[model samples]
Target: MTNTKKETRTVNIDIRKDLFGANENAAALNAETFKKHGIVAIDIMGSVGTGKTQLIETLCDHLRDKYRILMLAGDLATTIDADRVASHGVDTVQINTGTACHLDARMVRVALQNVNLADYQVIFIENVGNLICPAGYSLGVDRKLVVVSITEGPYMIRKHPLTIKHADMVIINKIDLVEALEFDIDALEADIREVDAAIPVLRVSSKTGEGIDQLIKVLNL
Candidate 1:
């Protein structure tokens, strides 16, 4: 008697699912680490020229006297942003993501390697400049602030809904140029509201410090 063995089908593994799931777990660990050190971590995400670094500098300047701050700047290759913030007397760790478009939890944890987290009361992580990729990765920060500038044009919000949906707060930056650019500030905010009805939105000109105080109050910094 010939016995035929049962057929077995190959299963396809979803790599993105595995990667994102791993990221979520790593993010949890990072959060616990930050909490253990009594640190308030903030993640700043935005497009390349959206003035994320400038906003961070503004924040560091405002809070440096009140808190021991550390800045982790993520970029593709250069140390430009990190160096810029470091010049502001804020301790900095630059995470060069190479080809990666976002700063993942694992990268942030490794960037803090051998450093005493207890030395810092606040940590600012400037994610690699991108709207989409950074939204998917959580660096275990208390809040993820997305800076969208009028310079980026009006379609930015309507074009990238997921970015707005994932952000804890939406910053309408470059509002100081609203009239000159004829950019409707309310229209941009309307786009954000459409994506996230309850998400707190603020207009701030990091250059002129417009609405910076309100932003700080909202951040509870």
Candidate 2:
């Protein structure tokens, strides 16, 4: 005798849009905070072993005298990067993201909660070692630098166009090993240019201090 039809209900959720929207809002707030404190924040993004930490260490060593610097290291579980930068005598805040692959705006805000923003003029946020996830989130930084190493093979630039597109600067690190590795730096630059016509590309060898000054100039640091 149960002849009544069950009510039909459907709910559509635009997860990507919603998630990014929330992140954008948080990012805006973060931007305002940085602006208010007069801090120059830079987001460093790249895959593992791309020498991101070393680059930050080099930058800290170079800019420490000119500006008070702070580093925020994002990782899945370890504080290795933070410790490395800290060894350079720069203050650091290690953000262990647990299972999260990327650092979101909210995470940055929370990390900076107790930080004395006025005590520092420059902040480097070393994003989680990932090419994909980090690009999807903004941590309210002045610039996003994606570090790609010559040792990571030639196809990395070709495979991650979106990441390059989002980057303010593309740093081809470990240039000192180019001769030994026989890597085609020109071809990789061309690939990046294909993705972004006018994006600034820099060749750097953090270990050897090669091109580090040029990078600093380009960054206006």
Candidate 3:
């Protein structure tokens, strides 16, 4: 018993769209709100255990007087990161995303209400520690900085292309662990160059205070 069916012709359709226009519009409004307040919001993206909070705290030490900084720390639960960062004498807002993966612009816009954005020169959103979902959404930020560690491996740049692609600056944190971890620093630098030729890579040891100054200079510029 052979059941044969006639071949059907296929039609090509050219359709372009953003499925969630509300999100896009809200992101635009979020940017407008940040600009109105003169806040340079930067979203920090990285994998889990990349030392994002520590690097940001270290940055606060140099940038405190230069700019009034506020941190919006996102996580699955708790205000622990926000609490820790606020101990450095800057305002911090914690957004518990529950089961969600990333922080979008609307989340940022809502969080801004807790603090006075006008008084701050920069707002840093320590996005949930995921390399993929965070890179797709804009948080009304002026810059997207990706943080990585030597301990993570020299090949992290290649594995997480979205973060590397969108990153304006990449912080290679935990340089103090390079020798102990047998990390290939030059190879890591080359990997970053291959992923993004224009983006700057910085090797910083928050514990020992190495290359921190250069980072500040880049931020100021």
Candidate 4:
């Protein structure tokens, strides 16, 4: 009798599933860490040139006196956004994602590893500039704010409904240029309402500081 050796096969693993599962686990840990420290972490997500950095700067300027703020800026490269926030007297850490499209929970956890979380009362994570990818990953934040600007054109809200669905609040930024751009502010807001009627939508102009106070009040900061 000839003995035949059993053949071994390598099973194909779904990397995306594994990746998201790992991210969720890490995010839970991050949430626990933030809660223990009494830190309110906000993840700011939006497309490029949506004025995310400026909004953070505006928020920092408004809350710095009342809270110790730490901003984590994520990008493909460079510390430009982090530097901008740092100039506002806010402590910042830049997470250069290289080729990664978004900031994941592991990245945030690793970024804050060296820092003392107890020193900060709030953490604003400016996610990588992309509406699609950032919304898929959770950075273990208390709130996720999506900044959509009139400069991005009318289709932004309709094209990226998932981002809006995932966000706790939708900020219509750069409203100061609404008339100049002939952009329909009410229509854009209506589109957002279509996505998630209950989600809070706020019009803000980080440039002129319009609605900043209202935003602060809404955030309870």
Candidate 5:
């Protein structure tokens, strides 16, 4: 059961343009487009190997029966992530960002132009695998989620405070290996609290299916 209607889209993105200024304006327009169709969009960001794609796969597996879902995957090349999720019977759009580090609102609007927006109820955007750049751009989504894995080491939250500050929720993934890796989840959580006093944090393992239900509850999915 797969729908590869819109596999992956590659757009010519000019990074020389005013990224901040242009992106903000375009984000607002994208917001209007989403609201017109009553869609719930989420922007997922994290570093390489942080399991952004796997988390989306878990989410799609959980929500596919309840909602008409679409996944918009942004990557430098290849449609691997989009292909993986599309196998779950969720429609997907791939945004090949050429040289850009993040998926801007205009890129989303352009990728969505060929598809009918009213056909879907939820949109999950998998941004390029970079923590720093993606935090600065807004994709006009209902929430921006940042996933941090214990495999990245404990200093991630401290080193990238702005990324944590920008996200609506923080997901600590791969917690199933916490004891084996001697990783301290509490201290890392303290670091996030230092940056954002009230952001919701969930501990999850895409493999073991732990804490995913709590995360979905927080996301109102």
Candidate 6:
């Protein structure tokens, strides 16, 4: 008779807690940073030339009386955007990312030092005009507005689900160009609905100031 020995195997277990809970954690930290200064942070995201900067200009023109406005412009490289937005008579800080595609938590912290968030009720972080990369980063904004212009075509909302998924509001800009480009508003809204059913979508023409009042109301101004 052969004696069989039972073998016991021990698995090593290691527990390492995450310092932050993914994207929301970063967003929360950003929220805290803005709260500390009593500033309302607005993160603007969109595709290139989607009238994003222009939208900010419009917002400033309308909301300037109600809130002190400041801006942080993010680009791959160049102060051109900052310069453009600053022309609106608001303090603007530019973040040249160089190789990076998006503005992260650390970038927001750095930009805060340049401008006094306490002086302004609102601080707008115009994220690198990108639909893809900006979705993954948190800038500590009270609201995230994803702008999709009619010039970019109706398919943008459907194509960039991630951007829509994280957006607190969606602005469909360039409605004035809709007639010229034969853009379909219904289809675009439907596409946005596909990605996010309950998101607030404001159709606006920064060029013509159409639907700007709706935006103002949405912003509570």
For every model shown, what is its TM-score relative to the native structure? 0.96, 0.95, 0.88, 0.96, 0.91, 0.87
lDDT tens readout by residue for model 1, 1-221: 99999999999999999999999999999999999999999999999899999999999899999999999999999899999999999999999999999999999989998789989999999999999999998888899999999999989988988988889999989888988999988988999999989999999999999999999999998
lDDT of 2 at 91: 98
Error of 1 at 30 (Å): 0.3
Clashes of 5: 2
lDDT of 4 at 1: 100
Residues 103-217, candidate 2, lDDT per residue (tens digit)? 9999999999999999999999999998888998988899999999998899997888888878899999999999999999999999999999999999999999999999999
lDDT of each: 0.93, 0.94, 0.84, 0.95, 0.93, 0.84
**Candidate 4, residue 115: how far the Cα is off, in Å:** 0.3
The window of 10 residues in a row where model 1 has the poorest summed lDDT is 157-166
Candidate 6 Cα deviation (angstroms), residue 153: 1.8
Off by over 4 Å in 5: 1-17
Specify the poorest-scoring 10-residue window by lDDT in model 2.
Answer: 157-166
lDDT of 4 by residue, 1-221 (tens): 99999999999999999999999999999999999999999999999999999999999988999999999999999999999999999999999999999999999999999999989999999999999999889888999999999999999889989999889999999999988999999999999999999999999999999999999888888
Error of 1 at 111 (Å): 0.5
| Superposed model 2: Cα runs more than 4 Å off | 1-11
Better by TM-score, candidate 5 or 1: 1
Pairs that clash in candidate 2: none
* Model 5: residue 78 alpha-carbon error in angstroms: 0.6
Q: How close to the true structure is residue 81 of candidate 4, measured as C-alpha lDDT?
A: 98
RMSD to the native, candidate 3? 5.6
TM-score of 4: 0.96
By lDDT, the candidates rank as 4, 2, 1, 5, 3, 6
Higher-TM-score candidate of 5 and 6: 5
Q: lDDT by residue for model 3 over 147-203, one digit each (tens)?
A: 888877767777878788877999989999988998898888888898888888999
**What is model 2's C-alpha RMSD?**
2.1
Please give, for residues 184-221, the per-residue lDDT of candidate 6 as tens digits: 89999998998889999999999889999989889765
